[model samples]
Structure formats: C-alpha cells, structure tokens
Target: MNFQQRKNKILAQLASRGEVDTRELAMALDTSEITIRRDLNRLSDEGQLYRTHGGAIPVDQPPLPFEFTQKATANQSAKDNICRQAAALINDGDIIFMDCGSTVFRLCQFIKNRKIKVITNSMPVIQALQNTAVSLNIIGGEYDAARQAIHGSMAIEHIARYQAHKAFIGADGLSAKGLFAHSEKEADMALALAHHSHITYLLCDAAKINKPSYLHFAPLETVQTIITDAALGQLSYCKKKGVKVITV
Candidate 1:
C-alpha cells in the first residue's frame, strides 16, 4: 500500500482493536517491523496515538488519559470520600487488591497504617505504601509511564497467583452500557483482577456517567460494588444487578 493508504488502514485497525503492536502490525500489513515502528512514531508525534513500548493507543478516549499527576489531582474530594468508604469495608486482616487510579490512591493514603495484605500493579501505590505496615505484592510487567500502571501477560500471570477478599478499582466511565477504560492493557489488568477477587468495587465520579468509550473491561455484573457520588442516576440499575452500591 502507498504511504497515505497504509496510515489510513492502520488508523482503522487501531479504532477497531483499541491498540496495535509494531510486530503485529508489520505481520498484518506484510511489512518490516521497523516501518511499522516509524509509522507509530509519526502517529505519536502527531498526537494521533499514545505510543507504548511496542504499541499505540487511540488518542481520543473517554478515560481522559490523564498523566498520573493530573489524575491524582482531578477529583481529590470525591476520591477521598469513596476511598473512605472502601477503607471502612476493608477489615483489619483482609487480603485486598487495589487497582490503579486516583481514587485508589486515596485508599492507599489510609492503607499505610492498616494490617492488610495488598496486591497492586500501581507504581505510585507501591511508593505510597513502601514503608507502611501493609504487606505488599507488586505485579510487575510492561509499565505504562503516563498512567504509572503495569500490565501485560507477565503482570496478569502474577495476578493469577494471588486472590483477594475485595478488589478496589478505579474506573473512568460507567453506565448501563458498560465500564470503560482507555487502553487495552488497562482493560486486561482490570479483567484479570476482577476474576481473581472475591468481591470487586469500581470507584468513579459524577463526570464519568454516561460517557461512552471504546473498552469495557468488565460489565457491572462482574463487579461487587460501585462507589460513586450521588449525581450518578444509574445506581438503581447497578443495585438491581447485585452490585452492592456504596454512595457516601
């Protein structure tokens, strides 16, 4: 294919699959992986996609795609509120899985003094809890620098070896349609974490409601609870589906 044609085709593939690796794109396009990497570099420089170590993610995403610093400050108040409730639900000797996000960051804010065994893929979570009393297990693999989170086959493998009494996840968009994430790696980690947990909780804010996005890691049915502010109107549906709703 010509240069323009190839770029157009790659864009379509990304929209459909959410992400594309250089080697996989090279094989599919019948070209050298070096060429695919060049295309990815160009696309990234143009603000068309997020360039990962070996792949790229669509630039337009409902998850806001904030850097870790920006995310930590985005919804501080709501995060604090939701995390308080999450910490309350977590008993003293519980085995907990903390998913990466600003909301969960708040939960980690309080977890330091606790006596819980915590498993997480968030670099910031590990940094925050490094000197704490909570026992820690860090899921390591391909790390996404912008999000400061880890995922991939290796991280998923580590997650499979652990089980948690409850999993507290940070969600981007939530609605009756599905729970959305920005990248396939995040979606995969969320899916794997949900299956390994005894109970799953998604923490989101009012802005995330009804905002449709590309990836749905797990439907509401897969989660045990959704902790959000009161402006979220779909609590009734979420509750009817057996998701323990926590709004405080």
Candidate 2:
C-alpha cells in the first residue's frame, strides 16, 4: 500500500483504539517499523497525533475516561515507577492513608506484602489488600461508581477521625500554587487525608506537573515529598518549597 493508504489506516486504528503503535501499524500495513515511525513523525509534525515513546495518540485527545481502569492505563509505566518509590518509603508497622487516585491505587500492588496498615476509601485498594498481610481501614461514604471509590462529606469526615504516619495521595494536576482535583469531593478527601497525616507524599507522573484542574485541593508545600517518573526540571523549585522530589 502507498504511504497515504498507510496513514489512513493508522488514523482509523487510532480512532478506534485511542492509540497506535509502530510495531502493530507496521504489521497491519505490511511495512517496516522504521517506515511506520516516519509516518507517525510526519503526522505528529502536522499536529494530527501526539508522539509517545513507541506510539501516537490523537493530538486533540478527549478528556480521559471516567473509569478507574481506563485512567490507570494513560501513563502506566510512569505510574508504576512512581508507586514503587512511594512504597519504598514505607516502613514496617507504619500507618498510611491512601487516596482513591488511580496512581495511588497502583501503590496497592507494591504494598500488599508489607506489614503496614492502610486507611483508604478506594474500593480497588481494599479488594487488593483484603487477603494480604496489610491491615485495612476503609472509609465509608457515598460511592463513586465510575472511579470505584468512596467520596462525599462522610468520607472526608471519616478520614479526619484517624491519624496516619504518612498519606499517599494523587492529584489530577499540580502547579506551584497547589495540587488540583477535577471535583470538590476528591479535593476534600485528599485534604482530609493530608491534614490527619504526619507526613504527606504525593504520587504522580511527570505529566501532572504544572497541569491545572478545576478544584485546588492542597498546597504544593503541604506535602512532604513527591514521587514521579521524571523531575522535569522542577526539582529545585520543589526543594525550595521544602518538598523533596523523588524521580524514578
């Protein structure tokens, strides 16, 4: 097929699957991987798609899906590394407050075997640790089915009733001013968790840095540390605010 034909096929695949990878495109189009990569670069240059490590997603990508699992896949590698660093900071027998953020949800896998106790409103976290060695305190409130978590005034109040050694939370966006959330309920839960914890650790991928959302939850300086896949040149500024930034 001609390059134009291949381009049409690639665009169609992206429209259907939300992303397209060089290897898969090459296989489907019966072309070399290098050729597919070149085509993707051309499309990126034309603002037709946004280039990622090994793939391209729609340039004008719609807002992320509301489901927890879908959101988890956006920056899976970065989230995994960030969670690894966050989990490493936990010591045996420590109490941690974990939020319902997709990034925080990944922390469940790394901490399942730890002797630490977890306080959370995330349904996924409870399901993950229910049979593990970790103790769990589930905050109860209104259920958010889309996110598979609990949120509302009750959930916020429940979190305030307990104190933890550390709080692991996620934010939709982050700026020098503060952490941002898409909704007030989420912001309230994060704020409550941070308030009741001795130390707060923010878990986020590099993309979240300087990204703004609707509701501003906690200030950037409020957190003791931030764990991400890349520092993205924000290390010095975070350090100046007394927030230690850890890059994986």
| Leading candidate by TM-score | 2
Every model's TM-score:
0.71, 0.72
* Root-mean-square deviation per candidate: 15.5, 10.1
Give the least accurate 10-residue stretch of model 2, judged by summed lDDT. Answer: 60-69
What's the lDDT of the predicted structure labeled candidate 1? 0.78
Candidate-wise lDDT, in order = 0.78, 0.83
Supply every candidate's count of residue pairs whose N, Cα or C atoms clash at under 3 angstroms.
Answer: 0, 0
lDDT of 1 by residue, 83-128 (tens): 8888888888999888787778768765667889999998767766
Best by lDDT: 2
User: In model 1, which regions exceed 4 Å deviation?
Assistant: 1-66
**Model 2, range 1-248, lDDT digits (tens) per residue?**
98889889999887655566677688888889999999999999998987765677677643333465567667877887888888889999999999989899778767767899899998767765666689999999999877778999888888878999999999999888889989888888888999999999999888888888888877788799888886558656786688888889
Cα error, residue 246 of model 1, in Å, equals 1.1
- Deviation of model 1 at 13, angstroms: 50
**Model 2 clashes, total count:** 0
Candidate 2, residue 221: CA error in Å?
A: 1.3
Which residue pairs collide in model 2, if any? none
